[model samples]
Target: MISAYACGPGDEPEAAAGWAFALAASTFCDVVVVTRRRFEGAISSALAARPELAQSLRVIYLDRHPALVALKRGQAGIYWYYVLWQRSLRRLVSRLHEQLPFDVVHHVTFANDWLPCGLVGATSAPLVWGPVGGASASPVRLARWLGVRGSITELVREAITRPLRRLWGDRAAREASVVVAQNHDVARRFAPVTAHAVVEANASILSDDLAAGAASSAAPNLVGPRRAVFVGRLISWKGARIAIAAMADLQDWTFDIYGEGYDRGYLERQVRRLGITDRVRFRGHRPRTEVLAALAEADALVFPSMHDQAGWVAAEASALGCPVVCLPFGGPPVLADVNAHVVSLERDLPAALARTVAALPRGRGERSHRWDAGRLPRFLEQTYDRACATSAVAEERPGRRRVPRPARAQRR
Candidate 1:
């Protein structure tokens, strides 16, 4: 059984994660997924093409109070809605399990480390929580300069999450047979509460044609780095401004930015102020294919995200054999593990980016893929086996979930 509060549409991060995780789990076992009712159409359409998954994968969409829907606009009360939904899910799953008799229960989405999981006492079956995140934070040095809007948003978010971390932190981790953290930071946060914490990225589809446009275009400029690309929302923490700042130093190089957001105006202004208007172009929200193609053709993917739990663009950039220049912190450092340059956060952000490009390794072989289909299934098998084994141990122990801490390297 999979509890993915957000599922389908294949767009929102949580929904994408839920859909990917549930799909992967279904490959190993029959999956009964519980998700929000709004996603029914997208999920149904996705399942339609894959008739094989029709029988093995069943989705249950649960709707929330009509008032909650109103509050969810602009994420005003989305947290409130999710909290109430999770509380209600406990009851739904308890009744569902009496009829279905699930062997293992998994809570797969809304990948926030602090968000409470409802599956804690819903069933006796082994529980798999997370591959979740939300522990990452924007660099204090960079965040302060993002003007009033960005600064306040980060401040307000941190303010809210700090206390909730102490409150819901234990409940989300302790009861699980396995707590699959999306990154090292998330794993560390749960370590104090549960011995089952392990670092594993949320599974994503590995395209069969990863080699389709894997070839890197030759650097056209003789003077400096030729070209760079960035794909993702143009939010303050996403570091699009930093990427644009870097373009100032790469005089001959061109930087193309995809995607639009509240920060687009700010980023564009920074570009003009940097006096790199000719080189830095904002291509606001392009198709994924166009973005991927641009990635293939670019010299580097400068994704300097401040606090990404699972930098999916970094993974995609790496898959296309593009060099990734990202921060030493957060999910980008892990996902952009090869053909990549990790630069430290400094006041002179542009210089760091320039130095990274100069230091980039070229003519590299195929990089490691964390989400390869063959690899993820094998990993899941081990995780399930481990969860069941530990669950058996917990059953014998009763009233306590204890196991030796995983070795340091394994912890990551």
Candidate 2:
């Protein structure tokens, strides 16, 4: 597995996904995980606590050059750094494959479809890409919700990156044996490139963790003044402002936002301006355990991310039997069960949130939905089997072989 941004001891969404996938993979087979040097400490610490994992998991940490590290301060900087890292990674993997002759290589993270996976077609081994995403776009009608600066920022970003994404992502999709899209939007985007594309959400919860959470909590009281929680970065696209806006009318409910980002000041100001400071609290970034604890206790999760490929917290909250009020778009809708409230764009977001909260029944126990943790390893194994079979058929077909493109310029 080639996961450039894998996290184990960390709590970011990408990191959590990477770590979970790695753990799940190790349960089935010997796993070699390639990740950034920055995560070595976290991965090492996690492995130290589990000797069984240490025996089966071989980790190779590749360091980012100091110059590149210093340059990666903003979004553009990070993207460029990732490009350089991919270039370096290809060389490293080529050398590793000479000795190991891997049967299949799975490119796991930074799950953006816009970014090319270096391993695709670089080695003789069959390659699987994704569950990759980045296809969701913020609805134009919701532009005013982000305010002027955020709206401009989003528009500028889209204008600059969309063309490049199509050019590069198309190429990457073409080279993959199977493209595992995180959501329907990403699958649609990749449809032109490959027939083997499939939708399997990247976010999942551990069965044991869900069991523990369920055993620990009794039914939540659905009585007066319900408590709503928002778990995610306080960015413009995350739509935390929509949750805060809804708090103005629902004076009976209190909202606790549990993450920090550049938009903290803007959100705090919005809260003050609405005179709902007492009802809304911005609890800066909390640890994963803490966030889950809060979710287990809260009445509902108000998530209105305009362009989230998948909001992992929404899935976690649902696994804990907590109701989620989210936009009908994105990965949340796929992960959310019948208990969740999907707010459509036809109605005002804030009004919809208020209505969902008011109508939600209290004293609900933990949900019984089966977590995806057990399913991912099997899905990955099936993808590998399919890729291997396809590769075998292509190898035997005379005059059907396509010339491999250079890693730097390759795209679907």
Candidate 3:
């Protein structure tokens, strides 16, 4: 497993996904995980807590070049460092493969499809890329809702990343044995590249947590107006402002905004401008445990994010049996429970949100759905088995192009 940005105890989505996937993979097979040096302490501590699991896992930490390390000060620097890291990883994996000659090489982190997976071409082992994404762009029609600066930033980002997307698509199609897209939009992007792709929600929630959340939902405790909570970074794309805008007409309901980002000041000002500061609370950033606790108490998870590949909170909210109100588009629809509300963005968002909020049940109810963490390991194992089988057939066929396997059937 090559996961450059894998986290150990970190709360970042990428880190959590990497850590959970790596741990899960270790349970099924002897796994070699390559990650950055920064997570060494956390990884060591976590492994120490599970000595039996550690016996089957080998972790290798790779440090970036000093020049690249200094580049962490800016976004460009971080990207450049990632590019350098990929180059370094190719060399590292080539050497590792010579010794171990592993069955598969899975690229797990920096899940964006725009970034090329270095280990794919470096090793003959069947390569699995993703649950990868980054194809979704903020809807141009919703530009005004994002404000002037936010709109420009989104546009600029699209322009700069266009070339990278092309390169990534071409590389993934030619080299990746399996491409796991996080949502339909991303799957469409890779359609031109290769048919060997599948849509799987990347977020992984523990079965125990889901059980606890489900149990919590059966009991109701409410005294005041129903509360709607918004989790995720406070960015225009995350639709925090949209939630605030929606709150203007929802005078009977209180809203809480968690997580912090560059959009904090703008969102704060919008709250003041709307004169609903008293009804809304900016709780800032909180630990994952605390965030889950907050979701348990809330009546609904108001996730208005426009382009999220898969918001983990939506799954968490569903597991807790908390109602979720999200945009009909993107990854949220896939993760949200069947009973959760999905407001259409074709008309006025605030009006749609208002209607959705008004229609939501005032009291807590059992979650109709919950994420099954057990499925992750099974699904990944199935994917690995498929990749290996396909790779063997390709080798036997020599020059013939292998037929793309049916994706949905493999999931079962």
The best candidate in terms of lDDT: 3
lDDT tens readout by residue for model 1, 175-241: 7889998888778777888998888777464564444444334332334457788888887888887
The CA lDDT of each predicted structure is: 0.76, 0.77, 0.78
> How many steric overlaps does candidate 1 have?
2
lDDT score for residue 9 of model 2: 48
- TM-score for each of the candidates: 0.89, 0.88, 0.90
Model 2, residue pairs in steric clash: 170-411, 170-412, 171-411, 171-412, 222-362
Model 2 lDDT tens row, 355-391: 7677777755357364467777777767877977776
Number of backbone-clashing residue pairs for each candidate, in the order shown:
2, 5, 1
- The clash tally of candidate 2 reads 5
Off by over 4 Å in 1: 9-13, 208-225, 361-367, 398-412
lDDT tens digits by residue: candidate 3, 21-72: 7877776777888888888988888888888876667889886866768667
Residue 15, model 2: Cα distance from true site in angstroms: 2.4
